[model samples]
Target: MERNAVEERVAQHYAGGIYAPDRAPEDMAIQSDTLFMFLMGEAGQREDMEAWMVRMAEAMDRIQELMDVLEARAEEKEESGAA
Candidate 1:
């Protein structure tokens, strides 16, 4: 699938609230991957594959952002000798 189409789907999914905020990023990634694999095994279409890829990418981005925030906080704490 084209990158634009994948991006559009990602935006739509985000706007549609397809992702649950309370779920952990790791769980989202795992569930997305598993669903994609299952769909592929069942002969999924290009759109299905693209949507799953977009979901996984978004989840990974969120995970990375969380890690960056955690790392920054850790650095701050270390510098201040708080923990």
Candidate 2:
């Protein structure tokens, strides 16, 4: 599936590293508060885990794709006697 605008923005924001965003302190605090609330007990019940599970599977697939690209580059370099 194609990435949405929000996903693209987030990926661009974090591509450098896990550094904090350039948002205002108030926005940051609000996000932290919402996350804390979700972590406490507002997230969901055990039966509502399918979405999270699918997200994990998708993450693994992305990792595999990245590995495949790296492996292909390695093979190409080896064939060319780069090192």
Candidate 3:
């Protein structure tokens, strides 16, 4: 949700190499959204929310990084006239 939080999550995801580039953004979005709802629905307190938020945030970041990588690969291929 927060920009810096999301950015951190994305950075972690990149470091972990969890998702493929083409699917990262969407996956991150879905994961983050799901986590948020889980917390809200459970009426989790600040600490609980914060904890889940951190984990989800990292996942969210990973997805974005993955997407970036995918996009870069695509561009590289296009430039090399390979696709």
Stretches of model 2 off by over 4 angstroms after superposition: 1-47
Q: Give per-residue CA lDDT, model 2, range 1-83, as digits (tens).
A: 23334333333444352323334324565356543323212222223445544554776798899999999999999999997
Each prediction's RMSD to truth: 12.8, 12.1, 13.6
Task: Write down the lDDT that model 2 would get.
Answer: 0.48
How do the candidates rank by TM-score, highest first? 1, 2, 3
TM for candidate 1 is: 0.45
On residues 7-46, what C-alpha lDDT tens digit does candidate 3 reach at each position?
A: 4444345436343233433466646766433433333333
Pairs of residues clashing in candidate 3: 9-58, 9-61, 10-61, 10-62, 13-62, 21-66, 24-63
Q: Could you give me the TM-score of model 3 versus the true structure?
A: 0.42
lDDT of 3: 0.53
lDDT of 2 at 15: 30
**lDDT of all predictions:** 0.53, 0.48, 0.53
Best by TM-score: 1
